[model samples]
Target: MEATIHKFEDVLIEKNEVQKMYVNGEWIPSSSNVTRDILNPANNQAIATVTEGGAEEVDLAVEAAKNAFYKNGWKQTYARTRAEFLLKVADKLEERKEEFAMLETLNNGKIYEDSLVDVEDAINQFQYYAGLATKPHGQTYEVPDEIQAMVVREPIGVAALVAPWNFPLVMATQKMSAALAAGCTVVVKPDKQTPLTLIRLFEIIDEVGFPKGVVNLVLGSGAVVGDALINHESVDKISFTGSTEVGKRVMKSAADSIKKIGLELGGKSPNIVFADADFEAAVDYALLAIFAGAGQICSAGSRLILDRRIYDEFVDELVSRAKEINIGPGWLEETEMGPLISKDHMNNVLDYIRIGKEEGAEVLCGGHQILDGDLKEGNYLEPTIFSNTTPEMRIVQEEIFGPVLVIQVFDTEEEAIDLANGTDFGLAAAVFTNDGAKAQRVIRKLQAGITWINTFHPTFNEAPWSGYKQSGIGGDLGTYGFEEYLYKKQINTALEVKPSGFYKG
Candidate 1:
C-alpha cells in the first residue's frame, strides 16, 4: 500500500535534530561517530538520525548515574522533593503532549489516537509515581530483651531501564518514574527502532530541572548498549520490557552482578469466549486485543479460545469486523491501525501467517499485506485470523506480536483453561462470560498473571502488573512496582543495659 505522508511539522518540532544520547543532562554525539537512521515506520521514510552508542558511552552513562546516586544527594533527597521533580516532569510532559504524541506516532507507527492515549498514560505514570514517592512506608516492630526493631526501604542505587519499541514513551515512564520515585538514579536505553520520542523526553527531563545524571538516555542496539547497561557493575538494578528470549539474556547478564532485575516480557495470551457471553462485546474486546497497536503489545490476546458451539459464529464475525478496519499512516484521524515497526517486523508477521497455513490452520480472512494507495509504502499487514489452530502450532503457542489472531475451539471450560495455560508465557489473559461462577473458576485456574473478565487491555496505574512463569519476573505499576527499586534494611537497637560477661544472673 502507498503510505500517506503527513507533514512533519504537524507532529514534531521541525527544528529538533535527532540526538544520539543524553548523558549528564546534555545531548552529545556518540564517541564512535557512528549514527543510525531513525525511520518513520508509518511511511518507511527516514525521520531523523540518532547517534549509535557503544560500550564506552554505556560506561559513561552508568558512571554518571552512579555519581548522581551517591555524590549528588539524589538518593538522600527528601521524598517530597523527589515527588516535586516527578510532578514537574509530568507538567512538562503535559505541555508537550501534542508534540510527544505526534513523535510517538511518527516513530512507532501507531494510530494518532492510540499514541495520544500512550502519551497521556505516560504522564499519568509520572504523576502516580510522584504520589508514591512521598508515601513510601516503613515498618516498626517490637522485640523482646529490651530491643527495638524496625525495617526501612531504601533506594537500590542506580538502575538501568531498557524499554521496548512497542510503547516507547509509556514503557520508559513505567520504569524510570518508579525508579526515580524510589530515589534511584536511572540510565534508560530505549529501543533503537523508536528512539526519537525518548530523545525528546530527555529534553523534557532537562527542562524539569532534575539533577544532572539523575536520568540518562542512551541510544543503540540491544546487543550493544542494552547488554552494557544490563551487565554494568555500578547498576544496582535492571528493569526491562521486551521479548522473552532477550529477557533471558538480560537475566543471565545480571546474574554476575546479582543486580535486582525486573522483567516484563512476552505473551501468547488467550482470550476465552463462552457461549453465554455478550457476543458483540466479546468480539469487540477480542478485536481490540489483537488490533490495538497493530498487535505489537506484549499482552496482545493472540490466542482466542472459544466454546465449540459459538466457534463458527465468533470466527465469522471477527473476520468481518477486522476486514472493515482502516489501515493508513498513524497521523490520520480515521486510521484504526498503522504499519508494523519496520520492514523486518512486517516480514516476520507475514512469515508467521504462512507458517500458520502450512501448519494446517484455516485462514478465516486477511493473510496478506494491505497494498492500497498510501499504505503501499508502509509496512502494513492486514488483520489476520486463523481457525482450527491446535495448541501445539507455533502460531498458537508463540507470540507473533502482530495483527494476527488464532482461533481454537474447546469442548468445555476445563478444556478452555487447559488450552490457555498450555503455553510457556503467562503474561495476560481474558475471559468473556456472563456466568460468575465460571468466570471465577477460569480466573483461578488460568496460569496468567493479569486476568481480564469481560474486558481486555484496561490496565490502570493503581494495579500491579507482571507475568507469571516465563512471561517475566518482577512487577510494574502500583506499590509492587515501586518496591522493585528498593532494598530492605532491618535495624535492631538495645533499649536496656546488657549483663557483662563476668556478671552472674
Candidate 2:
C-alpha cells in the first residue's frame, strides 16, 4: 500500500458547536465563555478556536475526577479493564492517525513527518501503558520475623496532567496514559497556545467508553488553569512538561498541598563530538539533535562540544548544512525545519542570537530571521550556530529554546567533561565517538539523566526518561513513569495471630 498525504484543509475538524472543555465525560463550555484563536505558527493564521477555562472549570474537573476515583470505584478498578480501555484508545487513534497528524502539523508547526511521529509516539504510550496496566505490580519481601510482608501498588487518585505545546499530543499522552493505566482519574491541560490535538484526544477518550470523570481536559493559561489544577486540594499528583521557570512555580504550588510531581522541564543539553567519531554520522545527528522540531524541544542539544582537533572543520560543515535546512510551513512535504511555535518565540530566539554575538561569540552561520517573500508573515528564523563561546557566556549558559546552538571547544577528555557539565541544566547529553571504552567512561562521567553514545535524540519507552539538576524532577516514561501515578502500600499479615504479652510499664 502507498502512503497517503493530506491537505491541511481536507483533514480539518468539522466545525460544530465549537471546541469546549471536556469534564465528567461531557463536552461543555467554560463558565467564563472566553475563547482564543489557535494559530498556525508557520502562517500566523488562526487554525481553530478553543474555549478558555479558568479556576472555576478546574474545580469542576477536579471534583469530577475525585468522584470517579473515590465514588466510582476507579481507585481499585481492575488492571485488565484499564488495559482494555487503553488498547481501545490506541486502536481508535491508529484509525484516525492521518487526521491527527494533519491537525498536529497545522496546530504545532512541526514538519508533517514530525507530527506523524508524534502521533505514533502518543499511540505507543497508550499501548505500552496498556500492557503495563495488566502486568504485576509491587514486590514481595522476606522478613526476619514470622510476619509475611509485601508491597502493592495502588492508584494515586486524582492526577493533574499539564502538557507543553511543542509536542502537544505526545506530551499529553505521556502523562495521561500512565495515570489512566494506573487507575487514577485525571484532569488534563494543554498549553493554551496549542490545545487542538489534546481536545481531539479527549473526544477519542470519550468514544472509547472510559468511565465518566476518568479523564478530563481544562484549557487555559498556566497562570490561571494550571495554578488551580496544581493547587487544588483534591489533586493527588501533578505531571508537567514545560519550561524550568514554570516548573519551579509548579513545584511551589504543588508544595502548598505537598502533591507528588513529575516534571520533564527545560534543558540545554550538550552534544559532544570527538575527533575519532564517524564524522559524517556525527554531523547528521548533531543537526537532528538541535534542528529537529525547530529546536523547540526541551532536551535539544543546544550546546555543541567539539574536540579541538575537529573544531574548525566540524563547525564549517555544520554551518554549511544548517544554512541549507529547508524552512517553510509544516504542511509542506519537503520542509526539513518549520517555524517556531509563535511570533514571541521567534523574537526570543533572535534576541539570543544577538546576545551570542554581543558575548563575543562568532556567528558561523544564520544569525537573523527569515523575512523573505513568502515567509514574511510567519514566525520563522534561520538555523543559527555560534562558535568561540565560553562557559561563562549567557548564550552558552541559558536555555534558548530555539534553533540557536553554542559551540564549545575542548582539548582533553577532562576539559570536555567539565564543559559538558558546566551548565545548570542536565537533562540530556550525547557523546559521538568510535572508542568503545571512552564512550562508556565519558557517559558515566556526564551529569545527565538521559545520555547517548554515538547517537543524539533517540529514546526508548522501556527505559526511564528524566533529568538531573535543574532540568526536572522525577521521570516521565518507562516503568518509573508509570509508577509516578501509583501509590505503594505495604501489607503485612501474621502467619498465626495471637495476642502478645502487653507491658503495663
Candidate 3:
C-alpha cells in the first residue's frame, strides 16, 4: 500500500520497498536476507519493507565497531573533532525537523506536535552532548603522599545501543549522541516494530560524516540482535531501553562477558493529586502524563493516587476531560491521542483493563477499543481509568504501558507516600499539591529516580534520567548519562627527586 499520508512522500515513505540496515557506514541487507514490512500504526498500512537481521549481522556490526574503536583512529581522535561531528548531526537534524517529525508521526502513531517535540528533544541531546564532548572530563588532585595524582575519564569501547520503539529517535539519540560524544564506537539496533525513523536518522548520521565503522545500525528482534550484542565479547558496553523482563535477560547475557550495561527499563509510576492542588492544572497534567504517547512511556504515570477529600469530584472531572480528548490519526492537526504501536499491544492493554474489571476495580471513564470509521483498522484504545483498586490488583502492580490509569484514594500524606512507592518499579513519581511543605515532604519520601512536585512529566535534557529499583540500572541523559559511557582511571607518579621509589630494596 502507498503511504496513507502524502506528506511522507518527500521523505523515505515508499510501500514494501526494502530498506537496508546500516553497518560499517554502508547500507546493506541482513546476512539472513529476511525482511518485514513496517506498518503505520495510524492506519495499519505498510510504509516500508525493512530487513530483519540476526546474530551474523550483529557480529558484523560489532566487529566493525570494535575495529573502529581499536584499529581505526576513533580512539585517538581529538575530543574537539568528535564534538564537531555531534554538533553537525544536531544542526542537520534541526534543518529537517519537520520532515523527521512527520516521519515519527507516520511510523510511531503519536500526534504530529508530539513527534516534533520528540525530534527537537533528540536534537537538543546531540547538541548538549557535543558541548560535553569538548569539556574537561577528568581532574588533577594534590595528594600529600604522592608527587602527582590524577583521575581521568576514558570512553568505554565498542558500545551496543539497543533502543525501543517508543520515542524511537529520542531514545536512539539519547544513547547514540552520548556514545559518540564519549568517543565510543556504537552498534545501534532499533526495535523491529519501529525502525523507519532510526533508519532515516542513520541517513543523517552518514551525511554528517561519521567515520565508517564508527557507527552502525542493525534492525531486528531483541531476542536475536539484542542477545548477540549483549553477549558479544568485543562489545565493552550495552545500553538498552525496553521492558524490565528483557532487561533481566540483558543483565544475564552481559554477565557472560562482564560487559558494562546501562538500562532505562520499565515503570509503573504514580501520579498523586491532593485536594488543594490547582484542580484544573492537576487535571490537565494528569491527562498529558498518561495519554501523551498513548501512555506507551516507560515512565508514564499509570497509577493515579487521589486524596480522599476530592476523590469523587476529581475522578468526575478527570473522566469528563478525558472523554473529550481528540483521538484520531496522528498526522491530523487535531489529533490528541493516537493509536497504540500495534494490534497485539492494543489487545494486551485491553486485557489488562479486562483484568481490572475482573478483579472488581471500578471503571470510571473509558474501558474499550475505539472502533469507529478508519480508526477501527488502527490500534486505538480509550484513555481508561479504574478506581476501587487495591495495591494487590494487577492493574496497579504491573506496567501496562498503555493509556490506562488506576485510581487509588488516600486520606493522609503518609498513605499517599505508601501508594506512590508501593510498586516494584521506581522509574518516576509525581505529586501535585498547593502545599509547598507537603509537596517537598511527600516528594522526598516517594521512591523514584525522577520526581516532580507539582508536575507529572517534564524530563529535561540537562538532568539525569535514572531508576531506583527494578526500573533497571544506570541511567540516561545529563552528566550521569555521559558518565555511563566512560570509565575513571587513577594515575599516580612518584617523584624521583624526593626518592619515593621503594623498588631499590
lDDT of 3 by residue, 1-505 (tens): 1333556667756665799999998999987889998889988988889899999999899999988999988988899999999999889899989889988888899888888899999999999999998998788887786468889988899999998999899999999999989989999999999988899888998898899999999999988888888888899999999999999999988988898999889999999999899998998898888998999999898988998999878888899999999999888777889999999999999999999999999898889999999899999998998889999999999999999988899998899999899989999999999999988988899889999978878889999999989998999999999999999999888754575467887
TM-score sort, best first: 2, 3, 1
Per-prediction TM-score: 0.96, 0.98, 0.97
Which 10 residues in a row give candidate 3 its minimum summed lDDT? Answer: 1-10
lDDT of 2 by residue, 1-505 (tens): 0233445766665544468999999998888789888888888887778889999999999999999999989987899999999999999999988889988988888998889888999899999999999998778889965889999988889999999999899988988889899999999999999999889888889888888999999999999999988888999999999999999999988887899999888899999999999999999899999999999998899999999999878888899899999999888777899999999988888888888889899998888889998888898888988888899999999999999888899899999999999988999999999999999999999999999999888887778889999999988889999989888899998988887658655
Question: Alpha-carbon error at 104 in model 1, in Å?
Answer: 0.3
Clash count list over all predictions: 9, 0, 0
Report the Cα lDDT for residue 90, model 2.
Answer: 95
Where is model 1 poorest over a 10-residue stretch in terms of lDDT?
A: 1-10
